[model samples]
Target: MDKHHKINIEYAKKLGLKSALVYQYVKDMNSDTKLHTIIEEFPYLSNEDVGNSIKSLVEQGLIEFNDDNQIITLSSTIQKTKIRTPISNRSNKIDKSWSPSEDAVEVLQRAGVDAEFIDGLLDEFIIYWSERSSTLVSYNSKFIEYCRLKWAQHTAEIDTKSVPRIIDKNWAPSEDCLDIIKMTGIDDAFVRLHLPEFILYWKEDGRAFVSWDIKFLDFIKNKWNYNVEVTSKEHTYKFDLFDPYADDEDKSKKSTKGNIKDLRKKYKI
Candidate 1:
């Protein structure tokens, strides 16, 4: 038996289910085999799985297949080493199942991401990193952190309604939302403070808020600085036009006015 042809359970675990089986079969054979022969030998693997396994084996340097020949052969490097007994560790049988840490879940959830989205991210992340020759991520913490930041950044980008364009005509900002203003270079604290209003301005103007962080900088660069006081005065005029004493035909309309007025004062429109 050639050592190059032999594989340990750990190596097989990394190769995963279909790839592991393909590797074991390749190791057992004395000569090169066609892709169809391996598929015929193992009836369970789907055509797609067989193809993926072959690609994985080729990437890992365990096997070689030339499109010209369409035959699978154990690499000469593997053929030169002495082989050992086949894998017997049932626990090492590989699959793609993985559980994300609770902290990682919480981090994403705080940013409005859910389980299904995280699962997809994890699948792509695992597949990408596992195939690379040298992984930069040496710890689970780094991986979790990567998921958390990327998830928030991307999630914010997709959520069309997350950053609303207008909360009533009179827009206001809270202390926390003020964080957005600090990052942008616009000097006016009022503009920084009424950042949400600016978001609403863009929204009402039919612009998509693609990047929550960048949109502010862009707004300031284009609009906010042009006629800052006029924007402020117009919002105030709209606020005054609202009749607080108007007939509340549908009692629900009272709350609407109150909400508008509250937002007006809160944002200092």
Candidate 2:
């Protein structure tokens, strides 16, 4: 088997370094490859880095995944002629009226980008490149790259705006979180009982989370379930040990001692 891998410089220039490396590896395989195989091949790159590069390759129509998402194959759209040609030999300055090719637009759309969004970016993209002295072999390739970056930034900005901030001292569960707990038949008082401890522990630990409400929900549910189980066991034990002649005060003392032991066990204190 051949160990040498050939990379298309045109694709490399358009996709950037990591994506170019991944593209060549996939192309060389000539068969479906798994995500882990790519990751393993590049020991220096982090898992997230490999994943993002694969995403870029897909967006640019260089590669695609199978139905199970475990196998990757080169896209039929990739042309051997284009890959073999040296881009620099044919490089030319961007024309003032340059627009993306229909194929380039189709590739972006196939990646789930909105058509109107692509249209909106046209004038700005043309103006920015036209003013630059740099030359490119394929303006269509450059356009696809530009659109992918802008779309990523636009969506990231929207996501950042929607969430706004991290966990704070004034953090509290959202109404939706409370409603979910209510649906589980856990009483509101039980939720309130653990609220202070939850807030104090999180605030003191000082870790940022995207949604504190979700953390609170999980914490409350676990604590509630544990309490229900303990209470049921205590009730059964009391029934088994019931004595008609036992003093009421003695029974109360025993119950208090048992609760203290349970509390100590819970806190590991």
Please identify model 1 stretches exceeding 4 Å from their true place. 1-8, 77-269
Candidate 1 lands at a TM-score of 0.26
How many pairs collide in each candidate, listed in order?
Answer: 11, 0
Error of 1 at 113 (Å): 59
Give the alpha carbon lDDT tens digit for every residue of 22-130 in model 1: 8888778857775545654554445456766777777677887754334567886333234221222233221256445564467557656667777777776666656
Q: Pick the candidate with the highest lDDT.
A: 2
State each model's CA lDDT, in order.
0.55, 0.67
Give the C-alpha miss distance for residue 92 in model 1, angstroms.
33
TM-scores, all candidates, are 0.26, 0.32
Residue-level lDDT of model 2, residues 1-269, one tens digit each, is 11334678987788887888888898888987765456546645554566668766666777875423345679874343332211224445777777676666787888656899999998998888878877543455457656765665565456556463545667666555664565455677888889989988887887765556657867997998899798878867776666765788888999999999999999998
